[model samples]
Target: MPRLKKTVFFAALITFATLLSIFCKMENRSNAELVKTDFDQQLASFQDAIEKKLLKAVLQRNEKEIKQSFLQTRAKYKRLEYYIEYFFPSTSALLNGAPIDEIELGENLIEQPTGFQVMEGIIYEQPTKENRAELLNEVKKMQLNLQRMSRFNEQYQITDAQLFDAMRLEIFRITSLGITGFDTPDALQSIPETASALRGIADVIAIYEPASTDKTVSSAIAYLDKQPNFNNFDRLTFITDYLDPISKYISSLRLARKIPTVASGSALHDDAISMFQTNAFNVDKFVGNSTQFINNDKVALGKALFNDAVLSNGANRSCTSCHHQSLAFTDGLSKATGISKGEPLLRNTPTLTYAGLQRGFFYDLKAGTLEDQALDVVHQKQEMNGSLTQAAAKINSSKTYFSLFQKAYEDKSGKADAWKIQHALASYIRSLAPFNSRFDRYMRGDKKQLNADEKKGFNLFMGKAKCGSCHFAPLFNGTQAPLFSKSEAEVLGVPSTTDTIKPKIDQDLGRYALYAYPQYKYSFKTSTLRNIKKTAPYMHNGVYKNLTQVMDFYNRGGGIGLGIPVENQTLSADRLNLSKLEIEQIIAFLGTLDDLP
Candidate 1:
């Protein structure tokens, strides 16, 4: 009887435990509801700073303050951008949300153009002759677009907040691509929609915030992220409705520029934005182009073809292989080295920094212009390792390339002949002009830009130090335009580092290669000191490490090699006797000569 009673008690205990478990789950669900409300409150506080300032600016209708508000709005856009990159992600759809920054968001709120500043981030264009006209036209259009951008802002009655919001929304749209190839049909389209979506964004205010009101839930706060969706449009559909138009527009525009988008715009070949435009030479960045010298399209083409590896005998080195762009078109090497296992390039890779600005080309002034220089590099066995015929054949093989010569010279039967290739390459080389350093800005009336010491240094360069006379202004080069003026070829008695004693064999006779003039012995074209800070280990041999060392070396009149100098063994025909402080100022000023942003 006792055992039967115990069994009944155990059954009762099991039922009790099951009831308790159900009660615990119900309490947990209440906690989850509380956590969600708290999360929403936290987001509201983030925009409170922006909301307070903007509301004040609008209510007061203070135009001065509104302008200030616009500037503040720019700051808020940055803060929200930081929040998205850090806290919330755009792809998250928690009951839908306003784009990170409302002010910067666009009226159109669509895809393409608004995100980036004009021409900042790019996928890299492949410049070619066939599509050259189209690319150039597009560039011109882009420049024109910049000129016309103010009209759109005025038409939309865009507030500063709207502009910033549009750009911010663009950031996420572009980020979605993330280093991949994609068309921006919608990128430009988004600009218009951004204006509308921006209105849908809610301006919420926190009514109350009290500590210990309720750890789980707050009835006092009311802010939720909610954004509008266009009719029958989910995210993908909305994006397409807005973005597809932009892509179609840009594609059609290419036709006027004679860009052969797959047999002159066959419907199948329409989307070339994502497809690679290899050998599209005309619109590409110059390896070295003649635009600065003279806008010769053929010269530009020749430069492009010559710089390519396909023109080489071993198919290894392009002309650019040695002479690189970042190195100011000088191969960072003292002597030029050929890529093949054959022979060392006999001469030093002379800096072509301002070659286009020169009256003559090459260390010896052997080549009169860019065309003369490119032709030598192509035919010479050690350089391009290609004859005119071989280079032409190599170009014809590229389906993209076959049309370049035809379009460039208007000769449908263009075999790789001498004229077209040389002209284009030379044209490309000459366009590289670098003048807008801090120094240039100072010259062009930004007086406060220079530090007191740098100003003193500028005076030294012009006066006591005597650098400006030879280095020259703007170009920091001696060669002048119009080629008729005689360019200076000074015998600066530049000591060859290979020699310790008074030199004989190691002496580099510069201009003597052409005229065989005795006075031109050891004369080399003066390089532009602009961006000299970057191109280091200075001189013909890459000898010195710093500007200070170079300055001291010159001050001492050709330091080690010509320890005991003969006549004309110094820099600047007049000997510079600068104080130590003066040299520091000179170095400080030289540092200012960077490519202007």
Candidate 2:
């Protein structure tokens, strides 16, 4: 009896020891560390595939094999992009940024394009001997980029907060940029790539999520699985039912876990909230040198100058002459009139509200900053028709203006010069950022703010209507969501008139006139949809008189569907085929964007 009791005691002790050891091991390997390990392995595999498959296919001049390899390479990259893009932005840009020359901020140096997009443009087109050399060079560059990312993954440490933030932003990125075919413009593989990206995110989330959250992940995958093709994909249903819910669940988990905000200098900052969140977007993010321009005194002085007719050459019209506050800062004319009656301006007067959020200014995107934009408007031939130099002199001529300028620029050593005048005007415009709209309020947890029809409209705008893909969320502007780094321009192929008879592509050669890029022909800066209800006579040319007309044009697939010859139309020629009810719902949502008094 004594020997049997001793044996039982020893056996129980051994079992306890083994269980404790396993617990210790599990505790040591955190979810974040495990996620990193998984990410590293995927990235390494992608790099290997690129070298073995992509490089060889390109060099051998095997078009069929090259296409197949490129698809695989792109898919692998998309899977890892959620982490890579957030942690190492410059490398990601080198790997997959648009094949266009982009001027660096502050430095004003233009960066020549490289990587996947550059290669896509080359390999997808008819490959010539000359193009083959370019393709080889681009492939080598991509290999180098991959090596850089691999090195970054080795040293970079990711926290739980960053992982959650990255996952959410990835959803936003896929929703806004991915499904819209923004990156894979030629291949049109956005749908498949998006599915791959979502799966990648799901795999990572599954590592940490509890059993209760499993349904969210499964539902998202189910939605993606149900889609027969890219065209048939119900974007609205996916956003409303799956993506948004999953994001919310993850966000809740993040909060419940008490995870810290993402570290600064990463792709997303701690303050960077999702687009769906109300009162979260900071307008100062868009304001270049915000500290220099965001002063209250500056805004006040700018408001005074905005209403001062002396800013115009004839002194008969101020900024308010074309932009009335009553009409949501729009003139309500088809095209703005010059100081001299009967003389029309170059384009319709776009609203000042949320205009400052855009990276580029004007229909042609000629102005790089709001200060430059203000200067251009001041000196335009038929608009303000006043030089900044003359405007400064005129402002100084008045005692009231002199005192206001003195107050506004009190911190500056120099007097109110043309530069200060431009800055002040830009400051006032920047203050009009869209943060207090009905939609914004609703998003901030006011459940009763949006009605059933309005909510449906919101879904349609984001989903089937394809508006959110271009307009984007939160700001509902061209400034890309998650990171409002740059605004985008689209070639909608808008016609001169809504006339069905002998429809003609507008003669205005939009951004093409500015930079002369073949791709930019008929391309106009994507403007804000905020206050669309009030800002009538839409489009740069003001061809569409109402929202219904505009919706119908988009439903019919812009100029291409109208039987107009627009070879360079950036908007997809695929008809949206939205019903009347859907169109009305979208319009109702647009109404919610209007700022309350």
Candidate 3:
């Protein structure tokens, strides 16, 4: 009887414990759902406010009202940028991408710029009665975008892991785009907008992991609040001290919670606390799995092939003939002499310093990759003038070349081919990525790296000067922020010479020769500004002889500002009106981009 009673009591206790466990799990799930619902409600509220303001601004056609409302809408978007950018990237870009339109070589349709940026440009450019109709249309597009986002939120589930990852990526976005003023170029409200975005992240984090909220989060907010005027704010200090620490803390919390990220491959690693961290930019980020053949042996073989004149038809010119390391990989000429040694080449020789990081190659962006670029250069009539077949046969005839190719390709069979040679050359070129510029060192918390003038120059570059809008941060190239996937081409309308009195637009036609599109009439790939001092004779035609001349051209607003009749100049025709001192400051900042030892 006693044994039976004891067993019955123990069974009852076990049953109660199991029921309690189930109930707790049910409660936790309900809480999660509630949190998600609350977040959705907040997003809906913000979107509704934006819609209301946009409609009001469109109807009134008041420029001041429109600008104010647009800024409000952008702030709200920034608040939810992390969530929307992660889940609905396409829709998000449609809502607020840059005002530039992009079209590929063979694509029939152009990826026209739509959204806030478009509207911003239209309204900010003149804000007159002429743009009222266009502004209204843009507002309608934004409304549709809001609807799309709402639908996405309604259907998609938000996981804790995703939230964590989204927050980290948001931190990266703030570092790359927010601080650099890439998005809000016209108004220069990056500093304030960044604070709002950070607050949004904190709010979301608090909802997901209430107990994990710590002093670091509040400290970041406080630091942002304490920032000075946009021009005077020390971006280097803010990023290194507050932002980096906050990012590290958040990453630590995520790891401690054992949260599984939704997508680990593309997401920022925990060690990447700041944009200037040694491992911040992945060397292989641009190189996809399909074409990653870089190794020491291959690079060695590539170096040999690059210097060898056997690849050229005349055996008198090599890759190094035009791209010498001493001159920052450029031939230091207005235009390079071809192997024929007849007339100058059509376009200027671009530097190979950061060429590997760029998606599109050459001034016209004809080649899609470094490999394609190498082959094209070798086979071009005016360039190497060498057929791949002939070059390959010549190389295979030599025992040393055959052995080097085998070692490079990891083929014991000892074969030499055109593809392998191109790959080797491309590998050598790609190995020239220089990330150790003085600017890089400064960003990595080395205060002594930049003097007061250089720091001020950096601020101007990112702010009022509007250089960062195109050059971008970190790489300081057209490789777009956060992802750094594709390079951007701009129709700057470069002239034939620096004769501002009688400037004539260069007749190259740039990418138009390939695409035959009017929009691509004067389009040229935006090259890396790295080592600009060394790679002078600026522009696609190398028209500007010095940096000062180039700055003067830009200050006057490219070819259009020089009174050259270029209808589709992508660069704004309005003069930058930069003072001589400001120009000097900018040059000082640019000097820090030199990566030479």
Candidate 4:
């Protein structure tokens, strides 16, 4: 009996010890997970800072702050790879009852919706090599977007700031933070806080009053009629011209490059910031900070710099020389001359009027975003004849330019690149978006109604003429779709009214050149019909001189003259042919699109 009792006691002790050991291991793991969660929360704080910087730069044109902020922000992207490395294994361990360090392998990665993946789409951490490609693409996108927004924010003030914040936060949440990788049902779901912030950004920016920023300049502009020696410039022209004189600088005769020796950032004082605060305690200071976006002095500097030969390679032409506002972005020519050769540019210079309505830019549609376009144009031998390296060197040399860059891009480095200048130009172009056209007013029902002629013209446009199918409305640039729509090109049979034989089909295939698709022979991007009357000699080749003449050609299912026989013509042939007065009405309606916002 004594022997039996002793053996039972030993067995019990062994059982108890084993169970205790298991429990201790489990407790330690739980604590580690808690630490991870805390770390993740801290990471989120840094992420938010990046989002704010990117958004502020894009929307508010806070070039200076946004510049450094963006560089720092993008530089942090490489660090995000750790997210996948750290979190995925832990998440898997929790779900599968494995050790926390056990890695989640193979296809257990995140996926964004088709368009939102990679460069243009959502971002994610932790992935297979395939998934890493997507993340890399997204990083590139952030880099591009940061640069572009940095440039463009200057044109629009406080309201634009709000918009930028919303866009940045929304993008960050969807790409960087959202559950784009897990098989969990709600992995892709957005956090409530982030979602709410996005709505708030839009609402705030929408209500921002631009008057605050331009109040000083507006006063000056209003008083311009009362000023003396004003006869040298027109009323509208003079107010526009005011930008150049205020920000004065010297340009080089041959290269037109800006040479700056000093630098200063504009009025960023605490009291001034407080003054911009609205009636409510709006924390973002959306209203109060509105004026921070613009500096008449900087704008004036930028404006004069735009026309000055000092910035150009050859010094013979300026941005205005190519993009004639009077001619509506186009120089009234299919292609313009550069310093290189008399040979025409590869494509027609489209109007700057409504160019801002787009996400991706350029006729080729190769640029993923606006900043890409801005940067490319400067570097192109046929374009601005400037390099980012050279631009930064030249601008940093200028004392005033350094200050302008600091105010605009927040650094001497920002001035070093062409981004700040390009974005400023883009903002100016975007501001050219005027939506108050007579036809637009009639459509919105602000006016009584379109007359019978215009009504008939509208019907024809929507109906037989079928112009709106490609040349869509509201923006009238390309087809109207939700966000991220591809720019469309058409193979219009535009025979040279100037010459007999039409240009070869392969010669002017717009998108085909980009994609090298044989199908898109002779296709060209559908330009905004807004201000079409102002830009004459239509088509990619400037084949037609007037709307009536172009319409007549389209009426015949492309040129009756010699050309690659019009196959796959968008316009139907010989069907709903129109009368003369009908043509006049349609022309009148098109004319309505001419007066830009």
Clashes of each: 60, 0, 0, 39
Put down candidate 4 lDDT per residue, 224-311, tens digits, no spaces. Answer: 3344221122222221233222112111110122222211111112111111112101112111234234344445545655665555
> How does each model score on lDDT?
0.46, 0.80, 0.79, 0.46
Candidate order by lDDT, highest to lowest? 2, 3, 4, 1
Candidate 3 lDDT at 328 equals: 89
Q: What CA RMSD would you report for each candidate?
A: 25.4, 7.1, 6.0, 21.1
As a TM-score, model 4 comes out at 0.48
lDDT of each residue in 315-362, candidate 1, tens digit only: 777878877767766766656676556456656676565465555566
Off by more than 4 A, model 4: 1-305, 340-342, 410-416, 448-452, 482-484, 496-506, 559-563, 566-576
TM-score of each: 0.47, 0.77, 0.90, 0.48
Model 4 worst lDDT window (10 residues):
246-255
Superpose all Cα atoms of candidate 3 onto the true structure and report the RMSD in Å to 1 decimal.
6.0
Candidate 1 least-lDDT 10 residues: 216-225
Task: Please tell me which predicted candidate would have the highest lDDT against the true structure.
Answer: 2
Q: What is the lDDT, from 0 to 100, of the residue 386 in candidate 3?
A: 84
Q: What is the lDDT, from 0 to 100, of the residue 404 in candidate 1? A: 66
Model 3 Cα lDDT, one tens digit per residue, 507-530: 899989988888889899888889
TM-score leader: 3
Tens-digit lDDT string for candidate 2 (1-597): 699998999999999999999889877988898899888888889988888998899889999988899989999999988888888888888999877776554674678888888888887889899998898898898888888778867887778888887887887787667776667766767777877888788778778773454678677776676773655566655765677777777777778778776643322335444556554555565566645547788899999989988788878878998899988899898999986778887799999998877788888878888989888888887887888887777666677777787788774333567888888999899888757888877766676788878988876676566777788776777878667787888888899988877788998899888666676789898899999999999999898899999999999988998889888786868788899998998899899999888
Candidate 1 backbone clash number: 60
